[model samples]
Target: MFPGTEAQEETLMMELSRLVQEQVQGSSWWELRGKDCAILGLAFVALAPGFLLLRSSSLLLFSLGLLLLGVSHAAITVKGAHLSSHSSLTRSPLLNRIWAVFFIEVCGAFSADAGVQAHIKMHHAHTNVLGLGDSSTWKVPGLSRSLYLFIAPLAVPVITPLVALAQLKHQPLLSSLRTLLMVSLGLWSHFWILVHVSEFGSTLSALGCMFVTRNFFSLPYIHVNIFQHIGLSMFSPEQRPKRIYQMSHGVLNLPRNLLLDWTFGHSLISCHIEHHLFPKLSDNMCLKVKPIVSRFLALKSLPYQQDSYLSRLRLFFDQYQELMVLAPPITELVGIQ
Candidate 1:
């Protein structure tokens, strides 16, 4: 039972959301299925050069290739694969999971099972709940604004997986085992390729360099996932209304940067409001649905949180002192009120 008879208000909001969705004929901004294909196709193109670069090239060329490969994987994993795997990118179950494996294991170099558990279960279920739903482990309390930004890139590959795996400690043994296997395979793939490259020269040195570069460039991908949701609202399950509010209020959409948007899909920024509303929407479809979502929220007198990229970057910097620092909310003094 919702208090204050806001039940009527909630109903009206839902109605408006439905009407706008109907206006768009239930399609999102673009061809949903087509975008998936385009994203995957481009990823494969990048992968080919990556494989060749590993086998035959100077260390400099090899490092650049690895860097590009990391970029490509981040784009495909976050944009192309994540939405589809969530079934937000498409309707086909078989195809969606297939892409999930390719992107999750091959490109993302992690476990699909782990990714799903951390992303869909914990993050979605208890977002920003301090130690519980915290996805921003890189944040340290009382650190200078500059320090957080500087060390953030180095923490991604090393820290994120450990945190994600910890979140899965309660999972069934079978599920956990499966995820670990996938993780191992992802690790082996990188090591194997690097070792093969080393056969041509100082393999040990090459391995060290590859490890450093591979993890370092992974920052952007890691940053997008955390910054999108962690700093936003953290509502109690009791007060939760519709999914729309959870997403719109709980998540902040970063400004549209063409290069980032094209690489990471709307999940990195756009479809989030729609995702919180309808988690099933694909990236391609989410854009189509954005107008509908915005109108619906507007009619209901709701706030749709969107900030410019630079603004968000600044916010992340400014709030560095409070980030990852457990603290209580502030209440106004008697006179101030």
Candidate 2:
């Protein structure tokens, strides 16, 4: 676990000094293009294999197809949609929104409306607050911790959009209408292929497997999400500071993990501090900036939290009780404070 601290005014100067040194002296257009292409390239790779797998008539082939579909979808959800929504993967509003639909709705079978609501609105704003932030989704006031971890991820995806819809119906007319249209379209497309597309085959087992595969992806997707933010420092609304402080304080950047970081980009776990600090920076840019960010934190004698994937995974499960059930004692609130 990382230690939290308060920075003196002079300390802030040192942190920023390292941040400047770490940046790619100057940004360029190609750097941005390269990242956008990488994101699209990965998307196509994930999607093409699934299409090929689905075309096969054999059950074994189809099962493999479903696995591919789930893995690709997970990558989009974590790597593509999550980062794009934050505008951390690209700059174009049009491109980010398009990726948003492809990832949140089409691939992940989740609504962009709810994802924004939970992630950008609630989670980013409140962070680890008791009931306001999306972190609360993992909490089970009275239930056993093990059961909560198992069920929370499975339940959130199904219920989050509905919660978003209900919350927005009377709020913004335009936003509400757009959300409804997007959600309806997304659900329609998913069911249409599963139920009516004859080529995909219509069978109880096939349909069951589709759902089962979707559910299976949820575990890791949720694990990464929770592991990145839940067990970290948090602060109340009243204690929150400037946007930069709020972002840089609580968030920690774990070391790059091979498969997970590649799929989810540096923003998922690695360079996470930079992502929170500068949401507009592309994933590649975040990776480029990590050394600067780490040095800044380190010079200030702060822990830029990082751990091996296995170690973090173990910590999550081991501390599930305190993180989700009992809640950590408010020792040193970081970002929001």
Candidate 3:
């Protein structure tokens, strides 16, 4: 019902911007960089004991190793790649590009350029619009919820490289080759760690170790991606609400989890509405600015979507056919021009 005029929308954004500025006071971007650096080192820290415990004969120690490996992988892919994709970690564009290639292609096993094209250019730009950022894009109607929610996620680690390679056909040959080399390097390094460092009994056993470790957190990974965006309002391009209205209505924030908060960052977790509203701000800044954003939205009588993680999970489980397997109905919406 808001966005009665273009002036109204602009006024909302201007005041919202001032509120965020007051909260941040130009909070240090370098602090974001340092956090990313620490996140990168999470791999080494986890891998040290992870592989050691994995190589031991004890089943409990091996399970612990599996968990650590999954944590490191999530830290790198979810947080590391996500931050670099947004160019949130550094002021230097060149260094940002370097980090993208390192975290996205090397550590995350995905193409950096493709990631930017998809996540930034399309997803962020057109959230909830049909054929653009619709949460339904992830649907696999062929697979039942049991397979998708439980079994299929285990294949994500295996499928990510293939998907990245398929996206490279549109890219320049040099760029594609770089993506290929980096993805291969990532796969091989994981394999090597299990084969050499863990000294698995056989090649198949080593691959099994890699698969389990890589996918240790995959269930939550897929769950988190869907929980925030799916079941929200969907709009057509022509009828999309104003930017503020669109984002506030379209995004949902889930409560924090220790592993998810650290690995996915506070942005993708508890502070998601703020993240979508100000993607340029790092998680630290997002947290800092949340109170301002929340109060402003409340005062403006605007939507600030928040729901529990389990509640969403239950809803999706109960209504998977409507929300995930089928294209959602576009909300009948009109906003300021």
Candidate 4:
């Protein structure tokens, strides 16, 4: 349904399918397992030091430790919860569901079911479709551009749990109760650890530490969420094209930075096109198959969208009026006959 002929579209789809098949055939399960374990280990490593230093008398040390903890939280949400929600963390469905409940619902402080519904079922299925897949972060109707850009993003950490709680009402009764229990237990466990193990001495300080650490990376997290799918073409359900065409036009990959790549995983900051093409592929596998996908797109003369992080930031700043302050108009492209 893109601008290409039916035969051309079929050829591209076939090539993409072949690339995915080849990648899957060559991949080792052990390698994926190891990578997942290592990243999960790193999340704990980032948090442990913060717990130990939470009661530090020195302000600077406490702030540094909190920053580390925040980075760990960000990494878990972006890398662990996101992947688990997609059922791409491992090959086992049971393990993926368990992982999603643990990382996404408990630690990430969001409902796993809601995440799967909104992210996988909706966002992935209908990328950049107006009122469907456009997960715009700055939708505050009367807010000024400067405040929307600066202040709104800082509220994400607080907003996450609240939104999760609200979304639970729409889920099935069993799932709603499970998410509620997990969130309650997760919050209580963190508080207990902070007060007793971390020796924070008082509940207020413990809560403060939790808040600071969890929200430290909120700005960047929100930025990355918006930058990828927003500021691009948006389609209606009827106007939407095939998967390959929709993703290539709607998604933009930010240039890879070592820190972001490690925290957010390769699928998000880089190799995003490959991830969109193969949503169920693990982040590491997406990186591995990036060259093949890129080359294939190039050969077919299809768009492979990529932009620098700074450039994207600048675009958001410069075009805040057009892109964020006002709702982006639905993109209408001619469908092939």
Candidate 5:
């Protein structure tokens, strides 16, 4: 239960929890595991062809292959790395940690441990808190809007690995070394495949391909990261309310989108309120209980923020200076005191 929630809101929370539990009870463990594994397997399958096609002499085929690989890489990062970091992909903590290291650190080219600290421990724990989880991952203060939108996103793939390396300074020596080794091996293995298996004429060309493919969808990725939270209310640490209230007011769900939904999962895209309410629930489970949660919130007269992606884009462009350039002000909810 959230601290300081009123009796009526508490009751609504209890009812919502019951409905979610009932929905989850009908799901099978195998089905959950199967879906996650299938997605990861598909990502690998997508990347495999890129290696094969890279060997072709045709530049068009090479570019097409790189695009496919890039999209698959982004999908794995979103659906696999993000879920595993939250321990929502599996019930076992060990398995979740393993997946995080593999998917986030290795394939996604970022630190798994840092992701847990930043995303799960910080972001989820303090959603929309000023200086905290207001989806500040892609912030580029003082940059021109055009450059911020176009050039900055393309740098994410390069910046990710560097950020991982920087994070090592704050970690224990042995653990840091281990992560360093794994990250190096992961990056080297991919490059080796490009050179040997893909038969890229030169290492420079292979490196260029890596940069292009890994960051192909970066613009949308960054947009989605900011779209859900930036324009919403931001609260100070002391002013933070109960989970349901904070999330409903702060998180905005985008309309149904095939690419965003498939890559980012239902919670980040469509069923955000349900997700913020039940952080432990899997993405599939979030989608399942979305209707129940939505109805319950509607009945309780709570905010269930939803917006179209295009509309958000327009709002962002119109208010870029106020929303992105400057820090957002804290929102004081009426009757909260």
Candidate 6:
């Protein structure tokens, strides 16, 4: 929908490239590795305090434990697992795979292989093409707005393992069994940690703590996931725009939420548009490149969509019938217009 003929598109890309080069470069190999290690180390540091606090008899101490544990979970899965899935944390595939196994499968309770395929291969590749990267994964039309946004997210901890198990049907037997074993090991080890380190009175107490801590950040997690993509321009396959236009039109950046920023990274929050344009960049790099991307898009008369999280929450609540309960109408973008 931005003004340009097909021939002008190449110039747009080149212009953007020049602008990018003028900006800061991407993360170095060593920096990415170090970044990954630092985040993992921080998660463990928080986890130690979390476990210790959980063992205290005071209600305030138990609540502190829940908060620390939630932050640790977010660090591992939201930041570590997401970056690893994109191969943004390392150059070597073996290193990326090992990191993914630990962060995505073991700590995050999802199949690493399935995550990469679903996210990078499909979602990122198909940004807002309907039924692809449209954030359809968060939809539940049957639920009312209150339940869909507020209540349903509480089941995320339970749903994650089930979804991981279900993806097994799509993989080869060896991969499935391996994923199954890793997931089981992760769940079992976490349960053991709760009982041994946290000093919960019984298996039930451990389970309850797990449920509470895991779901602590679920509301924001779900909110941020959907707010970035849903209600944006959706394209049918035949009428899809070119890559730049499509992503610009469909993707949105939410004003940074510190909790989400630390947990989910700038890729999923403040620099989402830049992340879509350059998926391989590290979170810090994405934040670094964001200004250049935004300026170039502005100069080119292309969209640089952004809105606040609460505004989006309000929008969804007001327009739930159209945005969630039914399929939004496919937008026919005039290419090279």
- How high a TM-score does candidate 3 get? 0.95
RMSD of each: 4.7, 4.1, 1.7, 2.0, 2.3, 1.9
lDDT of each: 0.62, 0.64, 0.83, 0.80, 0.81, 0.84
TM-score of each: 0.78, 0.79, 0.95, 0.93, 0.94, 0.94
lDDT of 2 by residue, 6-46 (tens): 55533574557456544545767656447645765675586
lDDT of 5: 0.81
The weakest ten consecutive residues by lDDT in model 3 span: 27-36
> Model 3: per-residue lDDT, tens digit, 1-337?
4547877887898899888876667666555456656766766688789888888888898888888888887888888788878878877878878988988898878899988988888889999888888755457889998888888888888888888989999999999999999999988988887888888879899888877777877888888888888788888887787888888889988887877888888888988899898997777777778888989999988888888878988998999998888888888655543
Tens digit of lDDT per residue, candidate 4, span 118-159?
A: 889888888888778888534776777677767877777678
Ranking by lDDT: 6, 3, 5, 4, 2, 1
| Clashes by residue pair, model 2 | 240-336
Report the C-alpha lDDT of model 6 over 42-125, residue by residue, as the tens digit: 888999899889888899988888899998898788888888887878778788789888888988889988998888888888
Model 6, total clashes: 0
Report the C-alpha displacement of residue 65, candidate 4, in angstroms.
Answer: 2.2
Off by over 4 Å in 5: 1-5
For model 1, state the Cα shift of residue 61 in Å: 5.1
Q: Judge candidate 2 at residue 238 and give its lDDT.
A: 55
In candidate 5, list every pair of residues with a backbone clash. none
Which of 4 and 5 is the better model by TM-score?
5
Model 1 has how many clashing residue pairs? 7
CA error at residue 211 for candidate 2, angstroms: 1.9
> How far in Å is the alpha carbon of 27 misplaced in model 2?
4.2
